[model samples]
Target: MVRARAAVAGARAAWIVSGPGARPTMLELEHEQLGGSARSDDARSTLELSRGIPLANVADGRRGVALARYESARAESASLARALTIEVRATLERVRVLERGRQVFDRLVALDAEVTAAARARVRDELITPLTARLVELDQLRVERRRATHAIALEEALVERIGWLGADAGAIVLASEAVEPESLTIAEDTIAARGREDAPAVLQARARIREREAAERLLAREQHGDAHVAIGAFLERRPSETATADDGGTRELGFRARVGVPLPWGTIDRMAVEQARSETGLAVQDERVVALAAATEARRAHRRLRLAWSQHTRDASRASQIDADLVRVREAYRDGRIGLDAYLAEKDRLTESRLEGLESELTYWEARAALERALGLSFEAIASGATR
Candidate 1:
């Protein structure tokens, strides 16, 4: 309820102070009327009217403060929205990575099961030891277990992310897509950091704070205590007994004017002014530090992680290619009785490990790219669209 009221007040203030068709002046009006009659006397009556005028400069300064506050709120809201977007994207990417990992594990399990079956058949024909068949079965079981663990972890992560988005668990249906490599060479770290300072919510929020404080200082300077001017008319009717002999029921009309001004107290006003100045100064310094530090830290850390992930991914890809060739040769050799079943099984295990490693490397690469986008205060789609 408090938040709702604040939102309503902010909207009203924004409209009144900054919206189109806003007037510079404020209008106030007042009216009063009275009438009475006694049995032994003539009627008596009175009427009064008044208007109030607010100082234009003071009013404008106050409006300026309100405008600054409204802008700060908007900046904060935008920052939160951006942060949430990054979180959702990162979480979705993690889910996708784990999903792909699970697929690799499934394939591994299936292949292991096939190898185990072949080993059992070989044992029945006295072509392989029973122990070899047992080892193959154990490998298959391990791969199955790993797949189950990965699936559970991925589901939990996805659910958590969906919850953060304020959606129902049943409503979320994640679709997998091809993961693309990040282009780190296109933009330098210093350039990205500079952009982050300009775009990051923390920096924007700090800058907004400084603006609001400055506006407050201006408002305090413009204010000269409190003052108002009132213009009105007064009218009265008197009974015959109170009227002069030449006048019948004396009637009078008069103009009324009033001006109110409070004596300015230097102590309190000076303190307020000083406080505003101090806050603005502090915010300015803080803003500079926060913007530079946040941008540099995120940019550098993300760049390093991305580069490392890319290198690892490249090596894993090459290793997987080599393993694939080795697996093909080993299988052919075992079928021709040139290599033992154990050697073929080892080659198959190596191939599985290479595939798993590649998946892990790809996952790390994607995660690093996502982190970089978050650090730079941008989204993958935005980066892909050539936005720095």
Candidate 2:
């Protein structure tokens, strides 16, 4: 099976996107502190700050802070551009990594196909030519042998879709005549390394987490207000509670007044900061754990492939021995070294041995394939790169 080839030379476009808008996160704390003063001044009109200036301007001030969070979201439009810049670039890197192996797979398919065809031709040239089916021969002698099997095909599975790659199925390659069935090899380390990183899914998840964090921090920051103390000298012409019987029955006095609170941040924003912190911790841990597991899986797959290769030579020889034994027994019996019952018994043994050897060979090949799949390396990338 083939994996999706990474585009290399004609690097279609960069996949990773990081840009200026990503800078906002850097200033999150500073903005959280300063943004309030700007909003308090600008939003006083909409927030009815003047109408409640005396008693409950507190609520109005909090509302002014809330508007800042909304503004933060508005500015986050920059992250989109940021994200695009990085995404396209990461994709191009991935493409380049894959293209190298694809070249090898292309040649592999051709060689394997040639050998397969040659095997078929050999049977036709040497075996089929001598076996002239004759009705008259059957009439002359009652020795009639029914062909037990039809096809001489050796490969258990058709080498269909040589470069067929699917989701990280990049490591496996088509078997060439020289590359023996079930053997695995790799060209690029980056493909495996990237696969180990599990970057795409991890990045996507991180994006959502970061967005939430920014928004959460905004939410928390709004809870508090600017740390300002009012130093106002209030000259009162009238007092609201009662009329002072000073001189004219109507009260008029000159008094200095100061009104202020430390800041609204503790009440309006700190809780949001705490929540964002917890969420960030969770996101980081999750990505770390997932990334580690993915890398371990890839590495394990790679190790298994290496082990499979170690056994390939021995398996091939064993399979060859079994084939030779089957051929020798079958010929001896057919040439009358044994009688009918003995011939039948020897033929049965040979068939079983041949079948077992084929199964063993197929098993080895399949194991090699599983190992390759783990490596996250693909031959198709090589071919595709060479094509471009």
Candidate 3:
């Protein structure tokens, strides 16, 4: 292929030193026949042929003839090497993807630890109740741990699905890279928007109305039933007789046939048309209603995005300014610069603000994904509203 590409159109070029050659070899056949009943005997036949139909070895007849023989052994070795190289490259890429997935799960594990520490500190300072608060914190910890474990399992399964392109888990276990997550938020609007296709189910109840209309139209068409046309033909069979059949001089053969399409008149088709209309109306009406509800959800996501942007900007500034302050927010609560309740409230508020920022970013992506669905486009499918 590379050599072909190097030659320009109509350009004189050197010929190949060698090309692929055919091989003539063995052929084999086998046949067997047998009777199921004991009364009959079985039969079998087989034929095998080997080293057949060899081409003329030109070297025998042409003395001192210059012929190029292929050094296929070397070429075959190189081809094998290239194939192995490609396989290794693919394996490396798969390994890298799996490694990234594992890293994500590792982060989740670290986040669980942080949640634990925060709960302990809060309890020690009497900022939260020991029994109820501790129990709540434990539940949250378990959930986070489970999430991390589930992520690990999912990544492992993904590797297996990709033909186990890397070494075993033990060989590729990542070193711990722990960082606790400070925020958690859900994108409900995004979820609802993505599931909008369920709106089609609303059309089912109105299908009967459409069916009735169709039946009425069909009935009307059927009223004009049994419609056909007839025509006579004059033939000169055995023309030597001259104007025989039509002229009554020879025997006449009359052929009659009828063909017509039956219409439904106004009965059946009308019912069907009505049914279809009803079904379509119901489907459309409910879908519009559902879509309006969905639009509200989309607007909510939009509102959240704006709120998150504002809060994120303000909190980021506050955090930056407070970086040099020695007084811990928790200490402030103990010292009454802030009440215990007030400090916890502030901490919660700040944590949520940060989480909202992150969720807003995620919501943007999710909203885009949802919009694609609402507009009936997948990621690869170009959206009418989308710019290039």
Please say which candidate is ahead in lDDT: 1 or 2: 1
After the best TM-score superposition of candidate 3, give how far the Cα of residue 77 lies from its true spot, in angstroms. 46
Per residue, candidate 1 scores C-alpha lDDT tens digits across 226-305 of: 45555555454555665676665666777766787766657776777777777787777777777666666656655665
TM-score of 3: 0.31
Cα lDDT, model 3, residue 263 = 46
Writing each residue's lDDT as its tens digit, candidate 3 over 150-230 gives 567556555663554444543554332211111113244543454342222212222333344443444333344443332
**Could you tell me how far off, in angstroms, the CA of residue 7 lies in candidate 1 after the best superposition?**
52
lDDT of each: 0.58, 0.39, 0.41
Which residue runs does candidate 3 get wrong by more than 4 Å?
1-266, 326-388
TM-score of 2: 0.37
lDDT rank order: 1, 3, 2
TM-score-based ranking, best first?
1, 2, 3
Better of 1 and 2 by TM-score: 1
User: What TM-score fits each model?
Assistant: 0.66, 0.37, 0.31
Candidate 2 weakest ten by summed lDDT? 43-52
Q: Pick the candidate with the highest TM-score.
A: 1
